[model samples]
Target: MSGHVSGYLSIPPLRRDLLIAYLAAAAVTVHVLEAALPGPGPWFKPGLANVFALVAFLRLGWRGAMAVTLMRILAGSLALGTLFTPGFFLSFFGGCGALAMLALLRMIPSSGLGVVGISLLAALAHMAAQIVAAWLLIIGHAGILAALPWFLAGSWISGVLNGLLTYLLLEHFDRHHALLTEP
Candidate 1:
């Protein structure tokens, strides 16, 4: 841990907040930009912004990850003018589900899974949460369940891509930022 900020607890409060702010801003930018792209469907997104959240989790711990996520959702929603809309809740809840999954996975032994595995699982959780949110909050019909497979398929692909991008980013950080690394 020499000279490295390995975990949330290890960082000075001001520095942690500053780091969270920087990560949140990046996540928000990605979230807003991604929303502008035309997707295969209304709900389909590559979730590129999640790479930052994963980076925060790996380098800064759960609190930092959660901070980035919450900020991204709130600020992204506002930026897109989707606040308090069905779309906003979907993103919010989906993000929460992903964070929850990441937290659970974090409790496991580090060797049990790699970044890609965690990303895949988190993506699935995000989709599942969105599906449930749609069913309960909007559709109110069992027919919505029929779309789960397709949504999960999309999640699988996006998760892998995002994870790989995150891996690359982490590698770069490890090469240059001596203070950032897994706890």
Candidate 2:
């Protein structure tokens, strides 16, 4: 071997990458556990996993949040045996839509929108994307559009609750763990 070594695997992961991996693992765990809980309906999940995504975004940035989301969806789907199923596709598209909205919102400097506001908008985007996915992939008809209002309403409620929880969690971290306050 040469005196020097240069390989991707040989390189140690950055702190940011480690943080991303930690957040993704947390999100995936929440996802799997949440999937087991009985909800009002298949679409009415509290989306507890998204709380971790929000935390990742705030602490690590959009890319970190995206990593957590992908990990949650993919690993959670595998755990739930929903891989390659309609549920997985719905989740993938919905997550993409939510991330897209978050990216757009992040561009607006000091928009006065707090975590709750951002979460609400993102949740709506997620619901809309899922509806469209349902129409295009499964139903193949406009009838799926009829459920938009209900889905949006549920999403709004879940988003608000999740945002409040995230806010509280962040506040606690800020008070008890100053290290988490920094990116």
Candidate 3:
């Protein structure tokens, strides 16, 4: 429990809304810490915090997923002082793309994809949307095109790892739902 913030794990499950709020707070905390870590650059994060949205997608459906994603981005950006900035827009659009892609994949009968499949597609979508945002809002043109390879590489690697972690986590929760709330 080192570095765990006080009152973070102390949420009372009085209602579903409260639970979602707690989850959003946890995701935002993860986002902030992950952003603080050393990485390829400001634009590159392993995106471990994104698992919250993926989990919401799997357990609560796409609406919950989008809700969690949006809340996480808003709260995280506010915490990191990125609100209303280019970074905020990037986070916002990227999340929207991820949820939309996940929804599309879910609509097709027997895409036969599980967590990893959804995660990969969503990650690519998120990156694409972010890149497009950057091109339109900041980077402007071919200069940003050169960064595509790096972004894609990061997305694939992190997406796979995060997806696997989420799969295992969901499996664990399925077996131990009670344990999750025993703060």
Off by over 4 Å in 2: 1-13, 175-183
Ranking by TM-score: 1, 2, 3
Q: What's the best-to-worst order under lDDT?
A: 1, 2, 3
Per-model TM-score on C-alpha atoms: 0.88, 0.86, 0.83
Q: Give one digit per residue, the lDDT tens place, for model 2 in 1-183.
A: 111111111113475687678778988898989888888785577888898788776666678779989998999999999998999999999999999988997788467777788778888898899999999999999998998998898999999988887777666543543343443
* lDDT (Cα, 0-100) at 149 in candidate 1: 93
What are the lDDT scores of the predictions, listed in order? 0.84, 0.79, 0.76
In model 3, which regions exceed 4 Å deviation? 1-15, 40-44, 178-183
Q: Per-residue CA lDDT of candidate 3, range 1-183, in tens?
A: 111111122224454455566567778999999888888664457898888777767765676677788999988988899999998998899998898898897688366676786788899899988998889888788688778788978898878877887877676644656436454
How does candidate 2 score on lDDT? Answer: 0.79
Which residue pairs clash in candidate 3?
none
* 2 against 3, candidate with superior lDDT: 2
Q: lDDT of model 2 at residue 167? A: 79
Off by over 4 Å in 1: 1-9, 40-43, 177-183
Measured by TM-score, how close is model 3 to the native structure? 0.83
